[model samples]
Target: MAKATTTIEKRVPTQAEQEAEALQEVMSAVAKNKDALLTFLDVLGELHESGALDMAHGALKSRHQIGVIGMNQLNKSGAQNMIKNGMNTMQFLAQLDPNKLQTMLGAVASGVDNAVQPDAERPQKKPGLFDLFKQMRDPQVTSSIGMMLNFLRGMGAAKGRE
Candidate 1:
């Protein structure tokens, strides 16, 4: 038997073929989302009717002037300082432990609530030195003192870090 002969050919897409493929893909997508596209057009028509489209066009035209004015304002000393302070505040907040801050805030809120509420049952009396000594024995007072001491230590350690 004579040996069989085979030929293989590779074809590259032409520009026209690529454009046709793109058009087909777009048409397919449009067909799939016909209702959505229609609804979007209706909403756009309503926006055009409301004069918002004109405002947007005008804003775009004045974008360069707006940007220049914004930059001028930011260049002012007060604005610059405000931005710096804001950035510093953000950095400070980022460094803090969220759980510890939350706990501290909860305690502060509780203290505020307690201060706002009137306790009629307890008589107001000035505590003597002995009363102060007695308070030191309380667990809550001791815990608060320890926390204050640690806070002072941390504050001291942060010296020169700025």
Candidate 2:
């Protein structure tokens, strides 16, 4: 008789596991480059306020690089609590110089205003009554309207029966 073979299946990680892994990577990175990490955060804060970050979305998407670099540095420095202390330092800096935070806030507000404001040269479209009526003639829209009308008619008939 031939020996029966048994196969073992590996379980895939769930969403929570993946998220935890990502968080671990970020924490490890933050712990490694205490000084450089602080500088990078400062730059990020400035860029975020200036709206430059939006333009750099493609480049900034590589958070893994930042994390790995930070982790490698932290591993070298052997500072396990770098991330915790860094947070404290950031809070202290913000408190110590309120003017800096105010300036950053002002920049962020201006950036938001600039982004939301429409350009004068861009032509604005105003839909006419005919345009609205034309949409009602579309097959999908007509079908949807028909369904709604049927529902309303059913409701009215039900009320009349009562």
Candidate 3:
């Protein structure tokens, strides 16, 4: 019969030995990721060659000055209005039905394309009142006029609210 051991003895490595173990692990990792390490070094080399690294270092060193300049620019009235207008436009767009907007934009594009044709290709004579009345009687033209009226109604309602 064999006697079983009841206690475990753990050996704590010395600082130098621990450092050596860490170095070995790092070396193995470097060897395992040789291609990635090389690619990273290549990117770093490119940045250095392009003077981007130097610019970044300088920017970091003078971060306070850069921040002040940025703040001053942003404080300008034009910058403020630009930011405000952009936000308002984004908000307005977000509120619209995407499908309807897309359709309307496509219609507008086609209208522009039709309007820009060479004079020889299009009717040289401006539509007479009778011709315009005939066009208004067309189903497509009637539908567009209805859409424009609805848009005007919405604008009127918005104005009332304001």
Compose the digit string of candidate 2's lDDT tens values, residues 1-162.
Answer: 997879878999999999999999999988897899899899999999998887688557977887898788888754768777988998878665588668657766865775577457634456589977986977856875776697699789989999
Question: Taking the tens digit of each residue's C-alpha lDDT, what string does model 1 give over 1-162?
Answer: 987668767899999999999999999999999999999999999989999988999989999998999999998879988998999999999999999999989977976776677368645577789988997998977987888899898898888586
lDDT, residue 72, candidate 2? 87
| C-alpha positional error of residue 8 in candidate 3 after TM-score superposition, expressed in Å | 23
Candidate 1 collision pairs: none
- The lDDT values for all models are 0.89, 0.79, 0.92
Clashing pairs in 3: none
Best by lDDT: 3
Candidate 1: stretches off by over 4 Å: 1-58, 124-134, 160-162
Model 3 lDDT tens row, 117-138 = 7347446577899988888877
Question: Which numbered prediction scores highest in TM-score against the true structure?
Answer: 3
Sort order, lDDT high to low = 3, 1, 2
Q: What is the lDDT of candidate 2?
A: 0.79
TM-score against native, each model: 0.58, 0.26, 0.63
lDDT of 3 at 56: 99
